[model samples]
Target: MITSPIWLPATLMAGATQAWRTAVQRRVGKTLSINAAGLVRYLYGIPFALILLGGYQLLFPAPFPVLGRLFLPFCLAGGLAQIIATNLLIMAFGHRNFVVGTAYSKTEAVQGAILSFLLMGERLSTLTCAGIGCGVAGVMLLSTGGKRMGPMDFLRALGQPAAITGIASGFFFALTAIGIRRATQEVGGGDPIHAALIVLSVTVLLQTLLQGGYLALREPGEMRKVFTSWRVSGQVGFLSAMGSACWFTGFATAPVALVRIVGQIEVAFTMAFGHFYLGERMARSEAMGLMLVACGVVLALLGAL
Candidate 1:
């Protein structure tokens, strides 16, 4: 199971694409409507899942009984909490000063690795542990810009509220990965396959309802925009769905800690896509940073794959 690197990288790539797409919406001065975004986040699975779900479903139509029943609620809470974290990121993006906050979030791999060990009984080999450490340093380096600041500088720049919110948001995403994996295990009673599908669907449903409710109350009229212009917003929605689905599948099949750590490949995906499609350029320092990040990923993959 650990040798399967395909879905893990795919999930990372999707994350990059999602961030880039979200940045596009920011450029248009009309971010994705909350409801539309929610739908995208939940139903995004539909585009890819549309064809695959049928086959995946046929593979595992039976229930896991206790497995599916136990982790369902945790999965539900995770889905809803994701919306809250999204809201925070959207707000931070609007503030235009969340660069550091975003970088701070890259440390989520560490958090997930630790939690995976503690809660899921996942153990890492020395190589894997070193790989994870390199991964942390590499991502932190990739996120850091030259001569900007040191440890104290970073600490001083982020106020308590921004720091708290960013850390909380990062933790929520890490937790989401763990929760999905936990749910999948529960669904493993009769058939792990069916359990995975049920967990994904249930999480999606809960996420949609919660996000939809919030949009109805607060951004009541913005729903019209989602349909009015389909290109940008639609892309974001679709990508969101694809990313979540990929992540769900990866978590279902592998150890949570491994999946989360290897998932850092998203940064590279974003950089590559940004260069080709968006004309974003990286300095030599930035490129070197990416190389280190890549090395970390390679290390993680060696142990994992």
Candidate 2:
């Protein structure tokens, strides 16, 4: 039987790997436009994803699983949403620092709960809902950059470009999560790892084509940059593909909301990356907000159990 413990570790690892990948991708952003930097995750990752998928299939030598009725639509929608979401996030990065920008995007867990409910008909229990509430509150806290804002100020801040892009990024990422989960289930109920790999391979391929085609026409020079910096881009691709594989496996086994809530650990990992590697520090309010985020993650996991 699949247990929370089994999938929980995958979610955590995905989060950690994703934080690193985003950091690398963000650096890549400095050289390219938001669209191109966002595209790097999929474009470079395609080769590595193909290699992993091919290796798995060769080792197993199993017949391909039948795709379900909803598979194509789900996979395509998820892939497209991810492309848009990534661009929005890179835009947020341009407006804010890395840690704060990531914290803004961390609103995905709550947004995931809502999207999972609406699209997948997944229902959250009272405890799970409460955990989501805590998480959303924490996201708001982090979004404020630790400033003590009254209601009017909070509402005003939400109207800002950075906040709008950040929230929009979260909403679309939630869609990606739901769509990917549905796609994973449609692949078959047998081996989740295999199912995840199939979905990941297909989705990454589609994203590569979509983004690559766009860049080819609109930003050829940036496309050249993506290739010229293969050393760092390769690391980003490897980490992104592996992290996404873990996330897809977790989605296949767990509820999307639960998986996303658990994925909140990414914020902490991002903070650590910021502090140690980037020499960045958070304000007291930011620290307190992150603490709330930690509490929400713990509560959500306990509720899941």
Q: In terms of TM-score, which candidate is strongest?
A: 2
Backbone clash numbers for all candidates listed: 2, 0
> For each candidate, what is the lDDT?
0.62, 0.85
TM-score of each: 0.80, 0.95
For candidate 2, write residues 162-233 as lDDT tens digits: 888988999999999988988988986487888888899899989988988999899999888888878888
For 174-266, candidate 1 gives per-residue lDDT tens digits of 777777777777764544445555676677667767766666678767655545656665566566655666677677777776776677666
Quality of model 2 by C-alpha lDDT: 0.85
User: How far in Å is the alpha carbon of 43 misplaced in model 1?
Assistant: 4.8
Which parts of model 2 are misplaced by more than 4 Å?
Answer: 1-5, 58-61
**RMSD vs true structure, all candidates:** 3.7, 1.8
Q: Residue 279 lDDT in model 1?
A: 61
